[model samples]
Target chain A: MKNLRLKAARASLDLSQQALADAVGVSRQTINAIEKGDYNPTIRLCVSICKVLGRSLDELFWEDD
Target chain B: MDWLVRISGVVALVCIGVMVYLIVKMSPDGFRKEQYDERQTLERLKAARAGFYAMLIVALIYLIVTSFAPELGNQSRVWMCVMLFFGIGTFCLYAIFSDAFFSLRQKPWLYLLLIGVNLLTQGFNLVNYFADGGTLRDSVGTNYILVLGMILLLLIIGAALVIKMILDRTERD
Candidate 1:
C-alpha cells in the first residue's frame, strides 16, 4: 500500500498539490491522502494521476515487497 | 446591496407581524376540545416533521449554491442568496407544510395548527406590505400569492374534515 513512488513522481513534475489534484479530477485532500499512503485511490483515479504526471503505472504506483 | 438589506427588512417585519398575530388573535376555539386533545400527539409530531423537512430542503439548496460561489471568489453574493433563500424558504416551508390541512390524520388539532400557520404567514405579508406603506409597492404578488395559498389550504382542510366525519360515522356503525 506504500506510495512513496507516487510522492516522488509528483515532486519531480514541478506541479503543485492542487494542480495535480485538479488534473486528476480529485480533491487536493485526496491527493494528499494518496501521497501519504493513507488512502487507496480508485483504478480510474490512479490511471488519471499517471496520465497527468506522464508516468507509467509501475513508476507511480507499486506495493512494497 | 441596498436591495438585499431592504428585502431582509421587509421579511423580518412580516415575520414579526405573524408572530404578533399568532400570539394575540390566533385561537383554536372554533373546533371541539375533545377532538383537539385526542390528536395532540399526532399534530405535534407532524408539525415538527414538516418543519424539519422544509428546513432540510433550504439547507440542501444553500449547500449547492455556496459550493459554486467559493470557486469564483464571489462568496459575498453567494452568502447573501443562500442566507435569504433559507430565510424565506424556511418561512414558506413552515407556512405551506406545517398546516394540519395536509395531515393524514384529519384530527382537530391539525386544523388548529393549520389555521395558526395560515394566519401567521398571511399576517407576515400584511405587515410587510403596510408597515412600509404603499410607497414600497413590492408586495403585491406576495399578497395575492398568500391569499390564494390560504384559500387552497382551507379547501384542503375542509376536505379532510369531511373525510374524518365520514370515517367517524362508519366506525360508529
Candidate 2:
C-alpha cells in the first residue's frame, strides 16, 4: 500500500517530502501520509505528484500483482 | 458591578479585535481568501464534525442540568456561551493536533503568540478580580464563570499547540 515507488522517484530527484509537497501544492504531512500508506491520494493529486517527480503514473502508482 | 461588567466586556472585545487584526496582518495575503490543501481541508471538516457533536453533547447536558435545577435556568446565557467555548476548544484542539489549524499562508507561531497574549490578558483580569475581593458571583448575581471557561479553553488550546509543535519537530520527514 505504501508508495515506495513514488518515494524512490522523489529521492532519485533529491527531493525531500517538503520539496515535493511544495512543488505539488500540498502540505508536507500529506506527502508523508501518501508515502506511509496512511492516505490514498486522489487521482488529481497523484497526477500532480507524478508530474512533479518526472515519472509516469504507471511507474509511480501502479500496484503490479 | 455593572460598570465593572461593562469595562470587562469592552476590554475583552478590544483584545479579540486586536487578535483578528494581527492574524490578518500576518497572513501572506491581507484580507484575501485563505486556502488549504486537500488533506488539510478534509481534516478540518472532520474536526468540525467532532466539534458539532461535542456541542450537541454539551447542550444535552445543559438541558438535563437545567431541568433538574430550575434555579440554573436564570443563567442560561452564561451556560450557552460556555457550551460554545467548549465546542470551539474541541475544534481548535483537533485541528491543531492534526496540523490542519494553520493555513498555507498563515504562520503558526504568530497565531500562537496572539493566543498567548489573549490568555495572559484574561489571566491578569482574573487575578485582579480575585485580588479585589471579588467572588465568582456578585450581589447582582453576575457570575464570572464564563470568563473562567474562556480561560480554560485558551489554556487547553495553547497547551495542545505546544505539544503538537514538539511532535512535529520530532517526527519531521
Which number leads on TM-score? 2
lDDT of 2 by residue, A24-55 (tens): 98888889888988888899999999888888
State candidate 1's TM-score. 0.29
Docking band of candidate 2:
medium
| Candidate 1: fraction of native contacts reproduced | 0.00
Worst 10 residues of 1 chain B by lDDT: B31-40
Tens digit of per-residue lDDT, candidate 2, span B86-106: 789889988987778888777
Residue-wise C-alpha lDDT for candidate 1, range B45-88, written one tens digit per residue: 56556656665776676677667765533344434344444444
Error of 1 at A16 (Å): 1.1
**True-structure lDDT of candidate 2:** 0.85
Model 1 DockQ class = incorrect
Indicate the worst ten consecutive residues by lDDT in candidate 2 chain B. B136-145
Off by over 4 Å in 1: B1-173
- Candidate 2 backbone collisions, by pair: none
